[model samples]
Target: MALPSADQTGNMAEMEMQWAVKAMHHAETYMQLLKAVGGKNFKLTPIDDELYSDFKRNFPDLNIAVLNDDDFKTDMAKAKWREFINKYENRVTDFNFGSLLRIDCTGDYSEDNTMFVMRTQFYCIEIARNKEGLNDSHHS
Candidate 1:
């Protein structure tokens, strides 16, 4: 198949950017809603112990345990992660706007703990967390 032309690629990038912006807006809304119900002190835990262990069991290299390890906390580690994650590029479709991944469920929010990643990955990690009631809104 022929590669997309420059115009096509540019249009796609523009669409992706718009989608990402909208996604970020929705995330803000979610944050507000969760805070209203769960309290201003609320923070979404990425996953519970069982899920975390399962995630590590399935993809040991991407486990949360290694997140702060010296070998995985450097620029080279980030690059390595990108390279490792790219291996799944063909499996994902219906791209979502980039979403944030927070390292700690507690403490003040900052760029230090948050990682922006593709919508699919955010959904993959968060869907389970949500399903498990990590992000349940208690206001109702």
Candidate 2:
């Protein structure tokens, strides 16, 4: 495969960095929000209850209480997420664009455990987690 020019490589790096910063900021803001108002009381939207139920219905095997990549790394998962993510595409901008998600929610979002996922996937999982008080200990 042809390699990118130096300028292209530089631009790619900058873009990646920008994505990371923005994604991390999203996670940080969520943590702060959770801290500001206990996770159980925090709602990402007026439809949080519906979102939580939908997520569970879509991924019955997913253990939001404790996260792991196994539930989301299979071919079936890719197809499942593709369908699940598309359900909100019209309502949420950049719904399928990549966002960083911590595989282990009990800790911070870091390169070590982070996985790239669609923005809506992040919201779906996170909103449910927060509502369930599973992500209450992030410490912002």
Candidate 3:
């Protein structure tokens, strides 16, 4: 379905909410990949330090604060959110991680309608032995 027009400023807040839900789905896919590979027992190598440094330099305009909590409440938060979204969008386009599984949204102009989209990335990594069988244990 077509996305709502960008001119609908009155619905910006709702649009932002929809964006957040979509971002969370992206995060969820990461979490699920961790689980499928062996849950907490798996060890992901730290993202390459040099690559991360380059990431910072190459995407100076991208905001990394979305990964932090305090930035979410500040007045500049919207810029940060946009940066975060742009970063992953670029990641999908660059094929740096894995694949963009989906980006789905709903609603046209109705208050009751909502929109959602998701992008997925996959990576191949060595899975450490499930020493604790943590996957089987329940934690609160």
For model 3, state the Cα shift of residue 118 in Å: 14
- Candidate 1 backbone overlaps, count: 0
TM-score of each: 0.42, 0.78, 0.29
Residue 29 lDDT in candidate 3: 59
- lDDT value, candidate 2, whole model: 0.76
Please write out the lDDT profile of model 1 over residues 68-89, one tens digit for every residue. Answer: 4443356886566456446445
Cα displacement (angstroms), candidate 2, residue 55, comes to 1.0
lDDT of 3: 0.36
Tell how far residue 75 is off in model 1, in angstroms: 13
What is the lDDT, from 0 to 100, of the residue 25 in candidate 3? 62
Every candidate's CA RMSD? 7.2, 4.6, 11.7
Winner of 2 and 3 under lDDT: 2
For residues 37-66, could you state the per-residue lDDT of candidate 2 as single tens digits?
767776665566776788888877787665
Clashes of each: 0, 0, 0
Write the residue-wise lDDT of candidate 3 on 1-140 in tens digits. Answer: 87766675456788677766655565455446544654454333343333344445644543332223233335685465345446555434333332222111111112232222222112111111122232322211
Off by over 4 Å in 1: 1-17, 38-57, 60-97, 107-109, 127-140
Candidate order, lDDT descending: 2, 1, 3
> Model 3 Cα displacement at 96 (Å)?
14
